[model samples]
Target: MSSTTRRRFQHPAALIGAAVLAASITACGSSDTTSATSPATSAPAPASASAAAGVLTVRDPWVKAADKGMTAAFATIVNDGDTDVTITGVSTDVSRAEIHEMAMADGKMTMRQKQGGVVVAARSQVALEPGGDHLMLMDLTRPVRAGDQLDVTLTFADGRTQTFTTVAKPFTGAQESYAPGHGASPAS
Candidate 1:
């Protein structure tokens, strides 16, 4: 083969190899980064709020701030033991906390304050969703941002009380789930 011809073939071959090497390096870097950060970026599982030694496990707790300085939080409560638990009362920095429900009435959503409070069956779970049953943080002193947490106290029907902090999130039009005895009980 002529020297010039050999030179042309070598240059093109080297260019192609460099291109392949660059593509491979980019692909490897992206995969490593995604794998390294995937777990941390994924949603958190759940956290628990304990009673006077009472355990209340909470999942995906989310709160929506209202323009009138009120906010609502919805979540699932799990009783991880044999004994049933009751959440009778709630308190927050906002105006008094209460169990409230958003229901459809006359083609409009209406909010009703609940007085019966919530009960988690023994070894069972209760979900507090939007539109049906949820927590009302009245007269919020501060805005509940996406990454913020709200500290609340929950009282039981047996006069046993438990306080815990809950993470706040924006509501996504989820219907609130209802359980018997789930509402804001009369404050003592």
Candidate 2:
């Protein structure tokens, strides 16, 4: 073969090999960077208020703030045991706290005490939220504000009680209305 022809083939082959090596290096570098930074870049899960019992767990317990009148507390009760559990009552440091239900009565929305307590089925969960079944806090000794914390206690059917610390957050979302002032008559 002519020397010139051999030179042409060698040059092309070397160039091709170099190109392939460069591409492979770039890909490896990018993959390493992604893997190294994944944990730092990814966000952590939002913290939730929780209390644990032998057979029960409560999550995301929170209270709505009221100037000086009435507000509500919500939580999720998870029953992990094989037997059902009934949440008989709720008590808070405020003046009064009770388990209340919002329902349509006589073609009007009425809020009243829930009879027989709230039952969490075995291996299931019950969520107490606004406009549904929740704990009503009335006659507050003082005003509640955002970022404040309160201690609430729950009474179970089996004579077991669990106390949870809940954070107070100002919520302006609409809820089931009471007859007159919706029980939030904003301090006289």
Candidate 3:
């Protein structure tokens, strides 16, 4: 990886904070009566055919509402497993999705396709939010407005796919400009 890319991964404190938040959300939302000491040992599993059931949980997922062009999705992806997992790609019916990272380019923060993939350390988590790593949704098929629900699927390096739903919300932040051929400017 380049020096700039390496620097982006230097923020351990942020990753840790995201992990803590994800764990708290999982604990609060779970219905299992099992003790905390008896944690599940299996590897991260894909969501079941019915609901979003798996060892990897996406907490508080939401997409930026946009009428056209591009927007992004943010969430805290928690991996409850003994080994690390890499998010290789993302897919949504509404638009094309790519794992993107915001980094300095030409003296300004630019958004581009992330090299390799997003790695969630074992028993840890990663946050996909504005001004950081996010899922870029381009070429929208239709308008995504407030209160709309989007079905997104995350593809893992190991070929396992986890499907989740992210609600569209009105967000004025991260108003970066997007050009069709050129990359995103002034990334948020």
Better of 1 and 2 by TM-score: 2
Residue range 1-188, candidate 3, lDDT tens digits: 99988888778767767666655555466342324322222222222222236547787677777899888888788877889899999999999889998898898787888978799998898989877899999889999987787898999999999888777766645455443544574322
Q: What C-alpha root-mean-square deviation, in Å, does candidate 1 show against the real structure?
A: 18.4
Compute each candidate's TM-score over C-alphas.
Answer: 0.59, 0.67, 0.69
Q: Write the per-residue lDDT of candidate 1 for residues 1-188, one digit (tens) a residue.
A: 99999988998899778666654543243221223212121223224443223467665455664444566776667787788887878777655678876655577666677657888898888877665677777666666665566767778888876665666544434433223233323223
- Backbone clash count, each prediction separately: 12, 0, 1
User: How do the candidates rank by TM-score, highest first?
Assistant: 3, 2, 1
Best by lDDT: 3
lDDT for model 2, on a 0 to 1 scale? 0.67
| Model 1 CA deviation exceeding 4 Å by range | 1-46, 50-53, 65-68, 103-109, 172-188
Candidate 2 similarity to native, TM-score: 0.67
Model 2: per-residue lDDT, tens digit, 1-188? 99999998998899778656654543243221223212111222122323222345666666776777677887677787788999888888875777888777777766778888899999898988877888888778898776677888888888988776666765545644422366432321
Best by TM-score: 3
Q: Predict model 3's lDDT versus the native.
A: 0.73
**Candidate 2 Cα deviation (angstroms), residue 126:** 0.7
Candidate 3 versus the native: TM-score? 0.69
